[model samples]
Target: MSIKSASLTIVTPNLADTRKFYEEHFNARPVFDCGWYVVLRLTTPYQEPEICLMSPQEGMQAFTGGAFLNLLVEDADELHSELTEAGLTPMMPLEDHPWGDRGFGLLDPSGVIVYCYHPIAPSAGFEEYIIEQS
Candidate 1:
């Protein structure tokens, strides 16, 4: 089976704030919004839905913690600068990782850690983990 697309829906107590956070930082636009639920898609050339935010319904529970969304960008430093100037404080400061990228993290309103990064040369011992895509 082939997966055409996918999105992660997080139950959040702050649905509006979560929606606004993604819109401002990730160039996300809502494809659907119904007071308690919002689906957001990035305005990249591909324009695919990437995130969904929803209020906790009767049987649902708000996300407490432990979700990390990693986004690969063209330039991490540039985006980090822009986000910093926009008043976002990084939870994880921008730095090169021995695992092979430069990145930083921001906490969204719904308790998700959004990590933005760009590829960098892998540190010596980590090079073996890079797999070429066929």
Candidate 2:
């Protein structure tokens, strides 16, 4: 079956705060907004991932730890500067990785790690890990 679209729904204790955090940091605009949940559309057109913030209830469990999103951007350095200027502290400084990525990480208001990255030349021995696609 072909997939049409995909989205991630994050359960948090406070939906409004999480929604506001995404809006301010990622430039997400609300497509749907309710007291318990909010659906937002990322302003950048590079990737169309719908981010949904929902207040945890009965069966829903909030993600208290770990990485939740990996966003590939054109320029991680520029984005880092932008986020820093916006008063968000990156979990670590942007650095080149052995897997051919220059990126950094940050924790969102909900404690989810978001990795922002861009592909670059692979580090030494990284070519051995590459498998040719048919």
Against the reference, the lDDT scores of all candidates come to: 0.90, 0.84
Give candidate 1 regions above 4 Å deviation. Answer: 46-49
Candidate 1 lDDT over 1-134, as tens digits, reads 99988889999999988999999989999988898988898777644658999999999889999999888888999999999999999999999999889999999999999999998888899988878821
lDDT of 2: 0.84
Clashing residue pairs in candidate 1 are: none
TM-score of 2: 0.89
lDDT string for model 2 (29-126, tens) is 99988778888988886666788888887997887776558888889999999999988899878999998889999888788888999989887789
TM per candidate:
0.94, 0.89
